[model samples]
Target: MRVDVEYLEYLWPMRHYLITCGDFKGTANIIAVSFCMPVSKEPPMVACAIGKSAYSCGLIEQNGEFVVNVPPKELKRQIYYCGFHSGRFVNKFQESGLTAQTARSVKAPIIQECTAFLECQVTQAIDTGDKRLFIGTVLEAYADEDVHKGERIIEYAAGDFPRQVYGGRFA
Candidate 1:
């Protein structure tokens, strides 16, 4: 069967994360992202695709830094909230009751509730017409002991895939 390119979102399940960014000494914002991945290893880098109009995109551009927080399946509601609402109007952390922990090398705060964090500094920005791809160098990476012991992190599939596909067993 031939598939419509526009409906290609079903091709694969994407992992969801809470990416935080802001000024060096100002308000911080969190946005849910599924289009993020590690692009390099030696100088470790990751690329995150964000809509140009997203508030967090502006913060990342201004600060040149961000934190990728790997959330667990339990935080699904919070993830949805961040993805659907605009951080420009609401404080996602406060509204979702997620704790923000100061990162070691970047100004952006990591979500304390997440299983792991990747603090990054922007190295490049690629324009893809509808979205901006920010390639960031990982300055620091750490994870909860449980995560090291094989705890599961969240993955989004728009409810198309079975939970087992993303609930750690497959990861």
Candidate 2:
């Protein structure tokens, strides 16, 4: 039997987000994609893939700044809203009822609901077939007050991952 990549495309959308801001200044459009990873550690680098048609792509390319926000489990509803709907019509923040906070080094606002936030400045962008690969340097990073020593970062595996509470034990 032969396998076709196109046939498996429907199996998943790989639900993760690659948020970006700073194109239009006040109105920073954030993108939600499944591609995000740490590329380097010596200088602290991260990378995410953004489709060309994605609204945030233009903003990121033009301004070269963005905040990588990892939304917590509690914000699943908001994440769904932002991930599915286009920012062209409604203000995702207002629609989803998520608040925005400013980062330390960049002008882009960070999503306050996320457990962890990475303030990054774009270092390079590479063309990767269908999507643009954005490499950024981490300028600043911090976790929310709610996360404890035993708490694990919110993650979406298989389907909707359940939120795990931590008591005090360190991993």
Candidate 3:
């Protein structure tokens, strides 16, 4: 069965992550993203693909820092809210009821409700079609010991990807 190359996103089940970023003064934002992954382990580097028009994109560019928050299934509603709403007008932290905590390495705030957090500083930003891939060096990492005791991280698959393949399993 030949498949269209455009459907390549269905090849793998992507984990949903709440990426938080801001200027650390009054411009804080959170967005749900699945197009993020670890690119290196030795230096602890990770990359997240953000649309050029995304509100978080500009915030990240301005501060050169961000936090990757791994949320559990319970926060799925808040995750969707962040992804659909624009931060330019809405304060996601206040609306989602997610607490913003100061990160140790970066100015970006970590979501206290998340299961895990990765404080990162942007190492590079590469243009990739409609989205810019921001490669960040993880400066610090922390996680809830109890939540990670088993497979507890929430996963997501866009549109029909879940029905067409692996049923959106988590890693």
Candidate 4:
């Protein structure tokens, strides 16, 4: 039997990534995002959706850059923490204990705990009702050599990783 799922549930089980915004010598934030995907290849581009009111959205708008950090299953708890808390009030980097290191292209920092990262400069921002779609041109991308060898790398993050199943989302 096929039961109806929520509109977004149809896209459930998407890989979650930690999106860091802001730059060195200033404020920054970590937000967990699952609505992320590759949208181009010529120059390499990615798209991620953020709530219009999210703190990350504002930062991206102000800075025009972001870093997408791929976390492993080991970071499930930190992922949940960043997803549920608002960066406006909480220092997710400090509270979640995720390190923010400099990115090669973007001013935004990448999460040190993550195994891979993509630095992108926002090329476009489109308003889509309650969510804003940010399309970014990849400026830099890297993967841990060990993880790149395909050794114990966990698969894309599961939807039930304490997300809605636990009761909250990034604000």
Q: Which candidate number maximizes lDDT?
A: 4
List, residue by residue over 46-165, the lDDT tens digit for candidate 1.
999899999988888888989998888788888888988898899888899998888899888888888888999999999987789999999999988855776744443233433332
Superposed Cα RMSD, model 2: 8.9
Q: Please, what is the TM-score per model? A: 0.85, 0.78, 0.84, 0.89
**Which residue runs does candidate 2 get wrong by more than 4 Å?**
5-15, 23-25, 145-148, 151-171
Ranking by TM-score: 4, 1, 3, 2
Instruction: Please give the lDDT score at residue 103 for candidate 2.
Output: 75
Q: Pairs clashing in candidate 2?
A: 16-33, 17-33, 18-33
Best by TM-score: 4
Candidate 2 residue-wise lDDT, 1-171, digit = tens:
964443323444444553758633566666665578899998999999887776778878888888888765566666667767777777777788777777788887887667777888999999998689999999998886547454665554223321221112322
Residues 1-171 of candidate 3: C-alpha lDDT, one tens digit per residue: 974444435555567789999955689899888889999999999999998999999999989998999887778788778988989989999899999888888888888888788999999999998789999999999887765675554443233343322232332
Question: Candidate 4, residues 1-171: lDDT per residue as tens digits?
Answer: 975444565456678899999875577899888889999998999999999889999999999999999998789889889988998899898999988887887788888989889999999999998889999999989998878998856665555634363223331
lDDT of 4: 0.85
The lDDT values for all models are 0.81, 0.70, 0.82, 0.85
Which runs of model 3 end up more than 4 angstroms from their true locations? 1-5, 148-171
Put the candidates in lDDT order, highest first: 4, 3, 1, 2
Enumerate clash totals for all models, in the order shown: 0, 3, 0, 0
RMSD of each: 6.2, 8.9, 5.3, 3.4
Question: How many backbone clashes are present in model 4?
Answer: 0
Query: Residue 76 lDDT in model 2?
Result: 64
